[model samples]
Target: MSQNVKVVQRASSSVRDKLYLPAIYDGMKITFKHFFKNLSDINAVDVLRYPEEQPQDITDRYRGLHRLTHRPDDSIACVACFMCATACPSNCMFIEAQEREDGHDEKMPKSFSIDTLECIFCGYCVEACPCDAIRMDTGIFSLTGNKREDFVLDKEQLLANKGAFGEVCSCARD
Candidate 1:
């Protein structure tokens, strides 16, 4: 079998193109245009003085931070199935299961923690949970901590977090 090989000629660059002055000027022109426009109308630019001005356009679908939901009796909805941890692509979630002592005969997480530093905030854990135990609807995107351990939220911390409406549990079942 014979294969036909096609050769293409390369385009030659002119002296102006080689100098790159035109490209630089075009870039500068666009930069100056935007700069002056923003200077003339500050509102036209989407610059927010953060801390003082929080984002107001966060939609309902926006996944910000993780939170644990609760049942009608205010018990954690997590059944310690490890579904959230398994679905987490970043391997940031950790859980320890224990038998429920409330005569329920079901298993529950004795300890559940998430390393925010390692978390990618992909919302996979929230989606993988079968009991709707976890959710990212807290709208608390400003995650900051001085120490590494502070970033790791425990079961109590996760349960304490509230949604935008100050509701501790956003469980749909409740």
Candidate 2:
């Protein structure tokens, strides 16, 4: 093969070009504009007086706190085969499996916890569960706490769909 080389050169900017900083000022100007706009519209803004106010409508797609769906008889629907644990990219899902009794429709989670502190809330665990037993449809995306143990989501909390109120939500039907 023949050896060949080609070179291209770009012209350097001048001191005047270096001195110009409109991009930085443009960013600052946007921030200042937003700040002033907020200041002027402070009263009109719908800032929730959260202690006294509540939302009436939330999107169905909102991924909030997780829920473990229950059968009509109040038994957990999860088979506890560790699919959620395996599907969780963040490794937040933990499961303890126990075999079902004779003729039972499903196996039960002897123990199940999604370590919320470690959960990235990507919804993979919810999507991976084949049995339609877990969901994140409550619109409560934030779960706050002071310790790691506090974020270990428990069965009681997992079972309470709140206003979903012991009923199946849209995620289940889909």
Candidate 3:
């Protein structure tokens, strides 16, 4: 479509021949950089010997894993709102809401479980919870199980972090 005729250009074969060697040398250069850097640190500061010694303080907003709080009455703090399950991106949370007939103000979660396998560690559910019932602050970085059912976290495990981890739940049964 252009009025000017396009001049055809040919790539020099010498450029192609030199490309492979440069790439190989670049790869070797990276390897040598790491090797020498590690060696220098080991001799001077001894930084290479203690990679595991430095641990990280997780951010206050870090979403590590799911947790449910148990009130002082040994009852679930969740009000069967299903906000957490609904907010979860992976659809890992399963909840069965049940009403309490003992003059309770709201319905509570009778059976709440989270499939650890399906969770992608996103914190949407934690942020969405209005009651502050569900949290992902156990500092638990990894979760595993032998069977499929073993990965399903129950209410007891969720509340265990509250007592042991010092994250108190001020929710009272009013």
lDDT score at residue 169, model 2, on the 0-100 scale: 36
Task: Evaluate all candidate structures by whole-model CA lDDT and list the values in order.
Answer: 0.86, 0.74, 0.75
Q: Candidate 2, residues 28-97: lDDT per residue as tens digits?
A: 9999998899899888666777646766666666678888887656667777768888988888887777
* Stretches > 4 Å off in candidate 3: 1-19, 36-54, 144-151, 163-165, 170-173
Q: Which runs of model 2 end up more than 4 angstroms from their true locations?
A: 1-6, 14-20, 36-46, 54-57, 99-107, 163-166, 169-174
**Whole-model alpha-carbon lDDT for candidate 3:** 0.75
Across 87-132, the per-residue lDDT of candidate 1 in tens digits comes to 9999999999999876443788999999999999999998899878
Return the top candidate by TM-score. Answer: 1
Give the candidate number with the greatest lDDT. 1
The full ranking of all candidates by lDDT, starting with the best, is 1, 3, 2
Q: TM-score, each model?
A: 0.77, 0.69, 0.68
